[model samples]
Target: MTTQQLEVNFSELINKPKATLAGLAGAKRILLRRRDAEDLVITTAARVEQDAQVMSAGTRMFVALVRHDTAARSLLLEIIPEAFPWVRFLSEESVRAFAAELAEVLPAAESLGNMSAVATTIAAWQHTAEVHSDPELLAALTTDRGEDYGPVPEPGVTG
Candidate 1:
């Protein structure tokens, strides 16, 4: 079981007036914002290595539009590898554990009510499967891993 990194950018998916960060604490799906002209949705998944780094962090094989809705408040959809299906690897227990974590992070609302369960199911599936190597995923995630969005030219700060 090797860890892999995956990521997607959907900046064009968001349409809301304001962007909000939201996620399913114990789940796999994390909603960024509602679909709009300027919105983007990026999803990255990886297997944790012994050093906690993604084994195939640089490779990205799966990408798609999980959702497109104006009424939806949060991004709704679980990311899965197109080449390797999750049902092949994860166990029931693993899924439950993952779901529990996601519930704590996801927003609390009627529209997001089912996210917990969905995240749990996805987690269960991922527990057993071997993720492929993806360089694209690694590059994207690593580049913005610790990026700062604050105003520049702060005192004592150097680029």
Candidate 2:
């Protein structure tokens, strides 16, 4: 059987009231702010699929993207964390270092840990950034380099 795809349009979704979006199955919400745009607060819901092994519960996950008028480019900051919440508290210094390192090595996508993996990843990124002080080089590693950068995880590891 072919699975049907669900398309989520951010512009339309943000219009409905929170009560409406919260009613959906697998709904999760977040508020986003952008450095360049007017404040935009939105809520979203999504269905998650589950994995049998690595994931204790089912592996399906959903998230809400929030941002202001910073242009789609600035929206990238929201995407990084929404994709990897585990790296939230890695310290500003550590995150900058990681972003710099990621600019070099893992330029595409990398698996990061949830709450469990933040510490290790922070250390690795710090080391890499220290060795290489090129902001442009680090920016290259992310899809949103030109926009506001978000938190970074450790090297050789992700949640």
Candidate 3:
């Protein structure tokens, strides 16, 4: 049986702190809904630590599996194309390289709790596959232009 998550409006939380907190008695966490802002989650410190520990252990196990088991690595490669159809855009060698780099980055990112880095890594590889899939773009990129290029503008800056 699935237990419903306790939900309390943000205004109710501020107006009736005791009652809002009391909802945690029957739930592991309470989702604080906000009409005008991002929603918030209220959970105990113990729950947070427990989740971190589980994630750490799971990361370690996955890293070990990929590193030591060829079958596991092969399975990952086999499923990767199915999981992300964009991977098919990449050559076999690029796909293998992407998998290796992902395996290396994923454990480190999880260890540091930096999921964004993992997302960026995947996006970077996907974009590379996209470029490789386009013959004209790939040719343009691979062709060296001897002309001097102007300096790149800083990110998020506009003229």
Highest TM-score scorer: 3
Q: Judged by lDDT, which candidate is best?
A: 3
Clashes of 3: 0
TM-score of each: 0.19, 0.22, 0.72
In terms of lDDT, the poorest run of 10 residues in model 2 is 58-67
How far residue 148's Cα lies from its native spot in candidate 1, in Å, is 37
Better of 1 and 3 by TM-score: 3
lDDT by residue (tens digit), candidate 2, 127-159: 555444555665576446377557776897785
- Could you give me the TM-score of model 1 versus the true structure? 0.19
Model 1 lDDT per residue over 1-159, tens place: 322322223442344323322222233433343446553433334511322222112111111121234222122223322333553344545444443434333333213433455455455445434331244654565576676788778789887
Which residue runs of candidate 3 sit more than 4 Å off their true CA positions?
A: 1-4, 126-159
Whichever of 2 and 3 has more lDDT, that candidate is 3
lDDT per residue as tens, model 3, 1-159: 324578888999999999999888788899999999999999889988998889779878988999999999999899999877999989889889988988888888887877778799899998998998899999999988887777878999985
Q: What is the lDDT of residue 55 in candidate 2?
A: 43
